[model samples]
Target: MSFNVGLSGLNAANTALNVTGNNIANSATTGFKSSRAEFGDVYANSLFLGSAKNGVGSGVTTEQISQQFNQGTITNTGASLDMAINGNGFFMTSDNGARVYTRAGAFGTDKSGNIVDANNNQLMGYGVDTDGKVVQGVLIPLKVDTSALAPKPSDSLSETMNLNSSAVAPSVTPFDAKDTNTYNYSFSTDIYDSQGNSHSLSQYFVKDNTNQWTMYATVDGVNPHDPTSTVPYTATLNFSSAGVLGTTSVGTPTVGAGFTQAANGKFTLTDWVPAAKNAAGVMAANGSAPADGGLVMNMTATTSYNTSSAVTAKDQNGYATGSLTTLSIDGEGNMFGTYSNGKSKTIGQVVLANFANVQGLTPNGNTGWRESASSGVPVVGAPQSGTMGTLNAGALEESNVDLTAELVNLIKAQSNYQANAKTISTQSTIMQTIIQMT
Candidate 1:
């Protein structure tokens, strides 16, 4: 009995040592969780003995090994693809068709542009639609689109400007784009066409009377109506005595051949053809057209004030075709790709999976865990949503193992092993003395 007890004790201590060694060994591993070994005592008794006041234990037996799921420290790695969870959640990945969960966020792009971990497991995420909105419920492998972004034609122009109410009209008879004497002030901006080509749209403002002005516009220094003609598109501006712009009192504003002003007082340039300077210094059509809905110009914010004529703010919605420049991830796990044209779009959103019983998960190799029957179904969601955690891009979570505590456990296990060995040795000595007495 003593020999059996000693052997069991030795086995329990050895298991403890092994568990501690494993914890210490994985102290530097990413997303590693520590574990502990538990033991139970064994006893044997007869039914006739009933409840004996003093019962000797038969031996010790291994009970179970439990895992600790404490939070680990996050460290910045400066890698764009690396991610770390700030709270509770795991990154769900797919190896072939099998799904696994992990806290290790060391990821990179595979050859096909899919985001994958070191084991080539593809990271699952919610994909975006054509409008760049996240589509939930459906899970797909996240991919980075490296194709060039198509250009968008200029469809709207918003300008806020102040025209000098005290200035006199220009002395010149006809409007000339090159002659400064022909117009009081000029504003020029770059607008994109359907083919991603750039063209200059210039607006020349001439003070006609105390509260009236004549505005002339040109595309590439030529008439928008006729590219071969230098005659520019003309419009009249009427301002009230209070310096507020009123409805048109002269020639009505027109765009293209038949496009006219809407009831909202906004002018739409429907027929402005994109043009470029030829080798002979003549502006000609470059085979590009305006946006599908035409370009709407909002001049309602323009006012004739006593101040100097100046454009306070002006903006146009258009951009040239661009290539991917950089990628970034936000706290909500939204992956954004910035283009060379100074535009950013959502590529995809990363989804995290959480379980009701994290300890119930079965450990798979490569720092991943498979969902077991004991572990409840995965509660998958985007980061920062509901009880899920937020993501920290360019960072990683270190192991939860504590080396100092493991080292102390190592010493305790070693002492327990020695004490058990002494027990067996003492029992053998007793047997030897009994044999000598015989």
Candidate 2:
């Protein structure tokens, strides 16, 4: 009986030492959780003896090893794909087809552009549609699309300018794009076609009278009405005595050719063919068509004031094809890809899984855990949603192990082992003494 008690004590102490050693070993591991060994006192029981008031403790037995799920310190790693959870939740990954959960966020892109961990396990997340909208309630492996962004044609152009009302008529009679004396002021802007081709649209303003002006428009230095002719498309601007623009008239050559005034008081150019200039300064079609529904030009903000003629604001909606430039992740786990065209689109959103009994999860090595019957089904959702925590991009979570505490535990376990060994040795000596007396 004494031998059995002493052996049990030794076994318990050894187990404690093993647990402490493991905790100390993983002190520097990322996302490692510390564990502790729990023990219970042992005693013999008999139905006939009932409860003995002076019953002596037999020994100690290992009961269980429990894990600590406390939050670890987050450190910035400056890697774009690295992520860290700030609170409760684990990053869900797919090892082949099996779902695994982990707190380690050291992730990178695989050969196929799929975001994966060191083990090549793909990370799971919600995907985005072509329009960059997040598709909820569906799980998919997150991948980065590196395809070039398609170009968008120009459909709208807006300009705001103040024409000098005190300016006199140009000394020249007719507008000549090559002669500055034929027009008081001129402005040019670039507009895109369906094929991403750019064309220059120039406007020349000539003061005709006290409150009237003649505007000549050209595309690539030629008439938009008849590309073969050098005569520019003409429009008359009539202003009230108060210097406010009123009813306007575009010359008959442009009334219905490609430019028309809409009921909303804006001009719409529906037939302006995209053209390019040759080396000899001749303009011709470039085989690209205008945007669908034509280009809507808003010039209602034009004011004729007694000031210097200048364009206050001008903008066009168009872009050329672009390639992916950078990737970023936000607190909500939304991944965005920025392109060289100065545009950004949603790539995917990372999803996190949380269990009701996190401690009941089965360790699957590599800092990952598998769902078990003891651990309730995973509650998966985007970060910062519901009870889940927010994500920190370009960062990682460090192990929660405390080296000082583990070292103290190591000393205690060693002392327990020595005491147990001394007990066994003393028991052997007593048996020896009994034998010598006999």
Candidate 3:
């Protein structure tokens, strides 16, 4: 009986020593939690015992190994994909078909463009819709869309120009693009078509008389609405005596295309043939114009000032297809993909899950945990919502193990083992003396 008791004590000491050694070994591991060995006294009563006071303790037995899920220190890595949780939640991931949870945020893109851990297990999160909004449905492996972004057709153009009010009328009778004497001032702007091809559109202003001027607009030396027609679209601008723009009228008869005049000389260019390089490398008209002309020339900001003609401001809406440039994550774990075309889209968000009892979680290796019966069902939510924690981008969480504490526990376990060994030795010596006396 004494031998059995001493053996149990030795086993308990060995278990405590193993636990402390494991903690010390993983002290530098990321997102590693420390464990402690619990013990209980073993006692038994004889069937013929007359009183309970006669019963004696047997030995110590290992009760349970409890894990501490405490927060660790967060360190920056300057990598956009590296993330760390700041509160009481774990980053959900998927392996084979089962869901797992982890605090290690070291993640990167895989060959299939999925955000994955070092083991290539995909990180789980809410997927995105066509418009880049979260679906709010079942959690799945988060994928980074790596396809090139399509180009958007030019829908509108805007510019503000000034005409010289003090300049005299041109000496030439008819307006000409090459002859400088035919017009008083000119301006040029680049516009895009459905295919993202660029075409230069120029405009000339001729002072016909006081508070009156004739304007001619051309696209790549041809009329925008009709590429075959060499005649440019013409309009007459009528201004108030105080230099404010007033009424406007088209000079040429409506021949299937021209400027659609609006209030305050704001004309919308109607019809446009998308310009492209032909077989001979020369720009030719392609039948790909915007159905709505897609060009808005704003002369509302035009003024008859006594200065040189100048284009003060200009803006257009069009771009070519672009590739992904970089990515970023916010505190809410929203991952945004920035493209080369100066556009950005939300890819996905890192979803987190918390449990009612973190200690009840079962370790599944790879610094991850699986839900167990002791732990209640996971509460799913986005970061910063309810008890869930926010994320820190470009960073990671260090292990929570304390080397100093583990070392101290190691010494205590060694002492317990020695005491148990001494008990066994003393028991053996007494047994030998009893045999010799008998």
Candidate 4:
């Protein structure tokens, strides 16, 4: 009977030692929980002798109980793809067709642009509109379009100019009718044509007289090749002596003066038509001095102006069509993409997944775990919202194993096993002495 009790103690101690060894072996394993052995002493008694206090003891039975889960320390890796749950949530993932949950965040994008976890489970998110507003009930797979994105140019532009009323025309002139020696004004800017082709645009100005000027534009060159009209555009600007803009005879209010178009599609400057003296009957041999020879002066335009002209031009509004450049992620998980055209755009935001219960997760190998019946449904959202951790780009998370604690537990289990062996040996020695004396 003493040997039986001693053997039971040895068996129970061995079971506990084995359980501790298993814990030590898997201390470094991801998502591993340690278990402990439970022991119960057995009692033997007859139905009639059950009331007696001197009942015989039978031995012990050992069983494995619940595994204890220790919260692992989280180490930041700083990767936008990498994620970590600080509290009670787990990340939900899928294995091919099966669903899984885990606390691990090692994530990446596939060739198809799908955001996947370690086991290739796609990360989900809410879809966003053009303005980045959430579209409810929309489950977007975390894939972004890597194609080229460009800036949208504004639709309108404006320009203003001022002229010096006394500058004289130079003696050397380039045009027989006009002086190349005149202030040849040229201002260039970029503008996209109707077809989205960008061109270097220039507006040329030449002083025709004191209060008048001529304007012409060379698009892409001194004169752009016009496929439809077969001619470059030319116009004139005219001002009254008081510097007030005149109106066209066709009832078009002229805020400023310019050449008028003829029925033949030709442009000509406005010249004084000596008021047809009383219907051509009262005209003198020479027309009376032309009404106040239009004020003479050189044109000097600056960056300031106030005009109501409906057609305004810009200095620089277009860019050269370019290819895609580098990409980056921001604090809000927004992906900003750059292009060779000196333009930038917001591509999309990264998605994060969270579960209701992390401890109830099922292990899926590769340091990943999956959702089980005990784990509630996954709650998907962007980082930094609703208990989710913010994204840190270009970093990874370190394992949460504690080596010092595991080593200490290993030593204690060894000592306990030895003590239990000694009890078995002492019981055997007593039995051997009793046998020798008999």
Lowest summed lDDT window (length 10), candidate 3: 251-260
Tell me each candidate's RMSD, in Å, in order: 2.4, 3.1, 4.1, 14.1
Q: TM-score per candidate, in order?
A: 0.93, 0.88, 0.81, 0.56
Query: How far off is model 3, as Cα RMSD?
Result: 4.1
Over 62-114, each residue of candidate 1 has an lDDT whose tens digit, in order, gives 99888888889999999989999989899999999799899999999988999
Deviating ranges (above 4 Å) for candidate 2: 45-49, 52-54, 160-169, 181-186, 204-216, 224-226, 233-249, 254-256, 276-285, 303-315
Instruction: Give the per-residue lDDT digits (tens) of candidate 4, residues 1-438.
Output: 467776787777677767667667766654455665777878876676646568767778784344454456556555556655544444545566565555556778788867787567876555567865555455556665566544433232234454343444445554222234544455566654323445455555556677655555444443332212223335556566765433212112222232244422123223212222255575322232211222111222221123322223333344445566766665455666677878766656655566666555565566666666776667776667777666555443344445576567667767766876787788788889999999
| Positional deviation of residue 168's Cα in model 2 after best superposition, in angstroms | 4.8
Instruction: Sort the predicted structures by TM-score, highest score first.
Output: 1, 2, 3, 4
* Winning model by TM-score: 1
Task: Flag the better candidate by lDDT, 2 or 4.
Answer: 2
Pairwise lDDT winner, candidates 1 and 3: 1
> Per-residue lDDT tens digits of candidate 3, residues 337-393?
999978788988889999998889999988999999998899998999899998999
User: Better model by lDDT, 2 or 3?
Assistant: 2
Task: Report lDDT (CA) for all predictions.
Answer: 0.88, 0.88, 0.84, 0.53
Candidate 3 accuracy as TM-score: 0.81
